[model samples]
Target chain A: MQEKNANQVRSRNEIFAERTSTKIYLEQASDDNPYIASAAVCHGYGVNEVMAKKSFADVFYLLFRGELPTPDEVQILQQLMIALINPGPRHPATRAAMNAGIGKTDPAHILPIGAALLGGEHQGGGIVDEAMRFLRKQQTTDAATSAAAHLESSTPIPGFGAYYGGIDILANKHAAQLAQLPGAGKALQWGMQMSRALEAQGVGWLMPGVAAAVLSDLGFQPRAGVCLYQLMGAPGVVAHGLEVANKPITAMPFVADEQYFIER
Target chain B: MPEKTFSDQQIIDSLNARRGKIISKTGGWFPGKGVFSHGYSMMDDLVGKKSYFQIVILNATGKMASAEFAHWVEVGYSCLSWPDPRIWCNQIGALAGGVRTSAIAATAMGVLATDSRTYGVYPLKEGVQFIQAALVNHQQGLSAEQIVASVPSRGGKPLIVGYIRPIAKGDERIRAMASIAEGYGFPMGPHLALAMAIERVLQEKYDEGMNVNGYVSAVMADHGFSPDEVYQIFTTLVASGVTACYLDTYHQPLDSFLPLRCDDIEYQGTAKRAVPTAE
Candidate 1:
């Protein structure tokens, strides 16, 4: 009687395990293609591969929030990014690991310590300090006067153009939204003046000064931009992980051949 | 004009009277070391007329560690010492309390030291905030009865407590501290840190015990400091009677034992200072 009962229990356990595994696999298969498609779209935008993942996260945030974040929210996001990027102050365990690894190692091999401890360069930690310097230089004076002084001083102006070329349509629209805010109209005007100055200097091909103006007027630290992108792309990593968990898909023959040559 | 002899009370009163003038001229809350020197000179006159009395120097020093009531024992000692005629001098440093307590402590101690109860020191705003945070934390988990029970009645005189930033010139800490100070509401005019450092060192040296003075003198002699320089440092230490002295060895020039002066200034927000006009 005891043996029969044990067999019945084993059968029930097997059924439960199978059901759980099946559910996970089905979920992974259903979401895997959509995640890839989203990643591909982000890649097309010229975002760095790591940032492409973040950009997808931003899309998720937008979809959830129903609008792009304001400058203040972006600043908060930047702080979060820094926390995500940097390791907590050195732990004794990590130090022990480092000490163990430290026998005549090349300094380049130690770069991972910084990479792991310091978040990616795209996170907005340092940018806030830089933006603050720029804002202070521009404060108190009218936008035109500030622009003129900034130009005279030969200070590098940020947010005056798109990253890759052509207009940054999103940034331009954001600037328009910022113009309606109190005390921001002047900033928008300054942005236009900066654009004209750049054009006069024969860099007319540069994108218009929208992002910088919006950021400054909103008191968004310059670091917020990278932070925003990082957050946007994070979902892509999750998506990729899901896809990888699905049945291992082999590439087409030519794609596999090309990859093999690239590796070589 | 005849040089008037002023007691500690008179000197403190003068400091109080000139507070506005000092701040406006120096662009800071506390007067420079030179101003303190002048006040000390006035103090000499009052001490000359009085019979020699034993003044115990209690140098209070500790990290602004946790907010426990026991943590403030040193602070309470300084406060308790204020009212005693025999314990005429006291110095407080690195205290973690709120702005109000710092102000109250400084004012109370200043009054006790000078025999005047209204002396005030304008510390950087950040320093004030730090003090306030400390006070708030200290007050937490305490009953009203416990607070009243903790009050010490002493030679019930007020003590003057001065806050000093002790970073050397051009050090990043100075800039960071200055920025924090500015955020708290007091901006350091140029060379404020240097002036504060010089004053703090002089004060600390003046307050040392007799044997400690001999030891310090010997150290100075071994280090090649002239007898007069040694004497000056000793007197300064005796006057300050501070428990802890932060010496900025990094940027301060070794040739002279003076703090460094740097040009870096940080404002509260991300703003930079306005461009300086060429001298």
Candidate 2:
């Protein structure tokens, strides 16, 4: 037998919003795909038209930034995406995903754990975004004063100094590649100088800050660039997750062993 | 292996012992470690092998949807995927974009917005339940009029409450969808035929046309979906257009889509009230 009546079922669904207004789904005047659309047209370029002619990099830029990137910008972004894609499984989020996978959890469930961790304030692209934001602010000033002021501040400057303090060769290599882009603005110039100064003080440049500088100069907002970090870092984590999930469940230590019961 | 026999009630009791998020054990053994579905291997057998629309219906109903039904679902999605970013649920996409968030965030928010009673998938659930109740009453040999009359007592409108309203004319989307379904040439089935009778009664009494939700619900009933299945399946389909709205407006300024200022609103309450001073 069915458990609930119509009203009884409907009553359970009420959300109890504090304020009420007629909800809007679409603007009548500006944006609507009327009737049947057999083919998708993006920014006046049809799918077939773009597919037969343009590269995916062009469409990706169009979707993300609302305009196709310059050829150089596309190349830069593509290279940056490749360069920053993974930082190995030792990253905390990847480690968490692998642990979840060890319990034979589905990769569908395990992959999201890494994605969520990447969105945090320190891991993934959060540090990269913070680095770009700080660099963008320091663009007007020269290296010495900007470095002195930021270094003296108590708040952690995420990009300039590594947590464990070592020069990141991967970040430095890609940073040089991206630094050559035609529209190297004040942000990139200031970012390089600050990295140099911070290095002298025993703090080294991490890949996130360098990547953030390249993305900022190419006209990405901090958060948007951070999304790329989240995207790039996913595969490595998922790979580790799949590897771990492939293991026998009996191999891992039980959670009961780790739990500490305190006597009151 | 030894053969065993169990009573019908005993089998039902065991199948429903654990009710978890993934329906892991209830109804069927769902070994979710790999491509766990109701019974089928979702990953190896279905993914990349079937059309996405087919996958949706297959997973939702545990079988391939009729070609005619699939066409209606496609049509229903096309009409609802109206690209306006300002609608109740579509606004979740717009709001996500305005905050400099990703399309994924907008998609998540868009799904949340549909968890509503007034405008969300909940209305579909209500509409389905209303029809189910009438179906029960009809199966018990009650007249259509008796079933319709009994609906008000159970928190259902004699005519289904809906998303779009026309003051004088019928909704064009409804007309288009009905025509599209007619083109399919499949029978509307018993449950859907009952819904159509209810619509006819409603139009005769109140001169109102079937709204999108009502029309879709009727069509869904024809597909042999239960109320819960209708609601869940509906959630998965509509987000196609909502996600598009987010991507379309990802780089636009906040004020670009729907503009409103404080001056646009009117105040009706008392002008001002002073808080009582602390002693």
Candidate 3:
């Protein structure tokens, strides 16, 4: 005989919020319709006022951080935004977008397709959280000791590691430039020392490492770093994708029969 | 190049060997001839002859399941196909439909949403692993009470993944599935026996019971299915539910699915202030 299921199906009655809440934005109802928003306030300032008074970086920071940035913070953030505007044409996320575009897939899907691929662990947003956390934890310690410990363990230090058998020269250069800014904080400074420590090991800054240091110094949470990395890299992915959107499928190389191998 | 401290020539060599070449052990199509999958000719042997569930299992696990097992798996899909938009994955479909997105996009997004660790397909892997490990422990002479005690607890209740459900206290789906299994004359396997024992201990001690994830994980483990295989098999478990939700909202007036007023959102942000000019 099948045993009767004695438990009754009942809701746990988890108390969800009565109204959806946000500390980020507030919308005022229009005079005519309660559903229509007449004005929007981000943090505290009116959206229109912000547009007139502040730069995009200040607005972006205010949206996330709940306060306007300092002059140094705004300048560093604006420069970082420019630095991370694209992940370049060779990146897998950008390549995925290009593939979709060239294949004549729906233009709407180019960003989504590429963004999804960018969520991967290698050279993507997946490691940004780790990089941020690593920076936070290691900034209190001696960077040279931490770098040596990680090297001895044969693990790529989260954020600091070798790229293609050598240090990433461009990433190194970017870090150096960002470090010179007045806004560079403890995390960024520690990452610079860590970079120097890793120089002999052929390990240094990768893009995520550089971004993670800046974001950590700027006070973004570790988890937010993941999506921020993806969001910042999205423009380049979309641009590169649209670049080849009108090209024929044959525009990309197709492996010849001789080049195709069946391992089994 | 900076003085090389790391030699990755071996790695580069391996990558170069496979450059511009496609190598596959799984079967692919030959344009002029036929399509192949797991060594079976798709058109000749599978299409009309085999059930879709059988093909799904074959493609997932590389082994063709019996028609009976396939039917059982198909029935399992029905257990999760609840069309209520209140469910998380289904709500994604509703939101997509409300925005007038394409059906394919809506369905795909809904399916993707089910990759969540808390309630959906990904949790099944942990569920299966827990039950399988518990059985091994049972064989090593640990009692059901011992197994229950071993798992970390919160508020004096065991925090096992498969046993406890999110929304409800006990699972109704388990009974529905058990009735079908009995009708099929499927023998009670050791893994399930241990699972029931653990559930008995849990229910008696903490008033908690086994969920559907627990039941399915144990049953699949008994049938020689690995955790990965089970996860792969049920990857689209909520697709039909998601589609039903999408269609429900898609046919309705736009932005009418639980429409919110401007005051519906409670603002907890900073007080109104002036924006400072950027230096």
| DockQ metric for all predictions | 0.01, 0.01, 0.57
Report RMSD (Å) for each prediction in the order shown.
29.8, 21.5, 2.4
lDDT of 1 by residue, A141-243 (tens): 6655655665678765544422222333333444444444544644555555554444433221111134334445545445554343333333332232233
Query: Which candidate model has the greater lDDT, 1 or 3?
Result: 3
Q: What is the lDDT of residue A115 in candidate 2?
A: 76
The TM-score, computed over Cα atoms with residue i paired to residue i, of candidate 2 is 0.44
Give the CAPRI class of candidate 1.
incorrect
What is candidate 1's DockQ?
0.01
Off by over 4 Å in 2: A1-264, B1-36, B153-169, B267-278
lDDT by residue for model 2 over B4-96, one digit each (tens)?
111244445655652222323312222444444445556776567656666677666666765567667778777777667756678778776
For the second chain, the TM-scores of the candidates in order are 0.17, 0.72, 0.94
Highest DockQ: which candidate? 3
Model 2 score (lDDT): 0.63
lDDT ranking of the models: 3, 2, 1
Give candidate 1's whole-model lDDT: 0.30
Local distance difference test, each candidate: 0.30, 0.63, 0.86
Clashing pairs in 3: none
Candidate 1: true contacts recovered, fraction: 0.00
Q: Which of the two, 2 or 3, has more DockQ?
A: 3
Model 3, A1-264: lDDT tens per residue? 113343566677888889989999999999999999999999989999988887788888887888889989988888787788888888899999999999998888898889888877788888989999989988779989988888888977888777877788878888888899999999999999998988976788889989899999999998888988888889899999999999999998877766655455
How far out, in Å, is residue A159 in model 2?
47
